[model samples]
Target: MTTEQLKLRSMIVTALFAAIICVLAQLIIPLPLVPITGQTLAIGLAATILGARYGTISVLLYLVIGASGVPVFAEFSGGISKLIGPTGGFLVGFIPGTFIMGYYMEKTSFTFKNAMIANTIGMFIILAFGTTWLKISADLSWTAAFAGGFTPFIIVGLIKAALASWIGVLVRSRLVTAKLLLPIKPIVKEESI
Candidate 1:
């Protein structure tokens, strides 16, 4: 494909992933503090498939759209309030989390193992940001924040991490093979002759 074609394709894919994040964000299991949504899963999938640059772009697009009053957040909620709300930290965290997840895979290998590790790290990043923000935003103690924001999501987060890893690797491989996404280039070590 020409450079223009590649750029166009990348843009389209990025927008598609943003939409995917929006759709997945609506899948919610409500809780007292924050709802368990599929946003993380979608973020993981975006990183695994789109790599660092495009994946981060997709996440940013999603955030901008939601922040602009589009009802793309959890439970069809949106607007800047959703971002500045107690749970906003998690949404904001998605940017760096997605970037790091994709960067890890790009640096290592786009395999299931790497995806698991990257996604796991990404999950913690989100939780850490969210918990800290939750504590401040809600004027709650750290312990209370941990209990509501961090503790409750551990097991569920792990499950989503595993699912994202398994499904992501599979889908990424297929996309690469089909030319929908570029294949990961293996790192070659150079030795002094």
Candidate 2:
């Protein structure tokens, strides 16, 4: 395939991953008032698979799609209103989170240990951005913002990060192996009768 075709294919893959993450974000874990979603898992996975640049682009596309009233955000909501809401910070944070994950994935990372380290960094970045933004946008104190935005999701985030890293590396390794094993076409020659 040509370079352009390869790039197109890469974008498509990134979009698909972002769409998957949006859908996954709607899967709410029941709680009293606030609920949790598996959104981070999708972000990390996309970044790990797509690498840094494509992963960031995929997340940006996801935000655009969600902001365009597509009902793809959590609870089937979308638009600018949601973009500026309390959860918006976390939503925005996903871009950097994905970037972090993809950055690590591109380096010397195949083992679960490396994945763990990479995902941890990604998760922390997401939390930092989300918490800080939450404080500024919502006009809440740092402690309160973290209490609302970060505390509830700690365990789940860790789990998601581990899962994304492990699964991503495993799949990437297999893909590499498959490509290495693919047979090359042999040229055929006809002899004169």
Candidate 3:
């Protein structure tokens, strides 16, 4: 494909992933503090499939749309309030989490093992940001924040990570085969002739 074609394709795919995040965010199991949502799973899938740059772009787009009162967040809630709300840290954390996850896959390989490691690390990053923000925003003790935001999600988060890894690897392979997504090329240093 030409450079323009590639850029166009990337833009389309990035926007599509942002929509996917919005749709998945609505799938929530409400909790007292922070609800369990499919947002992280979508983030993992975006990173595994789109790599670092496009994946992060998709996440940023999602945030922007939600913050603009698009009702794309969990429980169909949105706006700046949602972004600064108690769970907002988790929302904001998606940016770095997606970037790091995709970056790891780009640096190593897009295999299931790598995706698992990346997703697991990404999960912790979100939880850490969310827990800290929860403590501060809610004016709760660290122990309370841990109980509500951190501990409750560990097992479920691992399950979602594994799911994202397995599914992401499969889907990424198919997209590459179909040419919907291009495989990442490794960088090589040029030697003087």
Candidate 4:
């Protein structure tokens, strides 16, 4: 494909992933502080499939939609307040977490083992930012924040991360085989005569 065609394709793919993230956000199981949501799962998948820069852009787009007062967050919640609320950090954390995750997936061949490790680390990054934000925003102690933000969802997070990694890589492989998605090309240095 030409440069313009590639750019357009990237845009469309990123938008699709952003929409998926929005839909996944609705799959929430309400908790006291941070509700369980499939948002992370979608984030992981986008990262694996889209690579670091594009994955981060997809997440940013999702945030933009939510901040525009769209009901794209958990329990059909949205607006700027949600971005500043106790769970906001987790939402914000998705950017860096996904970047890191995508970096791993992009740098290495997409394998189930690699995906699992990348997603697991990404989960930790999100939890760190999220737990701290929950503590500060909710005025809770560290232990309370851990209980509310981290403890209640550990097992679920692990399962979701693993599944997102495993399934995302498989989907990406299929897309590659079908020539629907292009592999990331490393920049080549030109020699000056």
| C-alpha lDDT values of all predictions | 0.92, 0.75, 0.91, 0.88
Q: Write the per-residue lDDT of candidate 3 for residues 46-140, one digit (tens) a residue.
A: 99889999999999999999999999999998899987889998998899999999999998888999999999999999999999999999999
lDDT of 2 by residue, 45-152 (tens): 777666778779888988999999998888888998876876787788888788877777566555677677878888888888877877888888988887877787
| Span of ten consecutive residues with least summed lDDT in model 4 | 179-188
40: Cα error in model 4, Å: 0.6
TM-score for all predictions?
0.96, 0.83, 0.94, 0.92
lDDT of 4: 0.88
Name the runs in model 4 displaced over 4 angstroms: 185-193
Global fold similarity of model 1 (TM-score): 0.96
- List, residue by residue over 122-150, the lDDT tens digit for candidate 1: 99999999999999999999999999999
Backbone clashes in model 3, listed as residue pairs: none
* lDDT tens digits, residue span 1-193, model 4: 6767666777788899999999998898878678899999999999888889888999999999999999998888899999899999999899899999999877776888888989999999999999999999999999999999988877998999899988898888886665557777535568999
Prediction 1 global C-alpha lDDT: 0.92
Worst 10 residues of 3 by lDDT: 180-189
Score candidate 3 by lDDT.
Answer: 0.91
On TM-score, the stronger of 1 and 2 is: 1
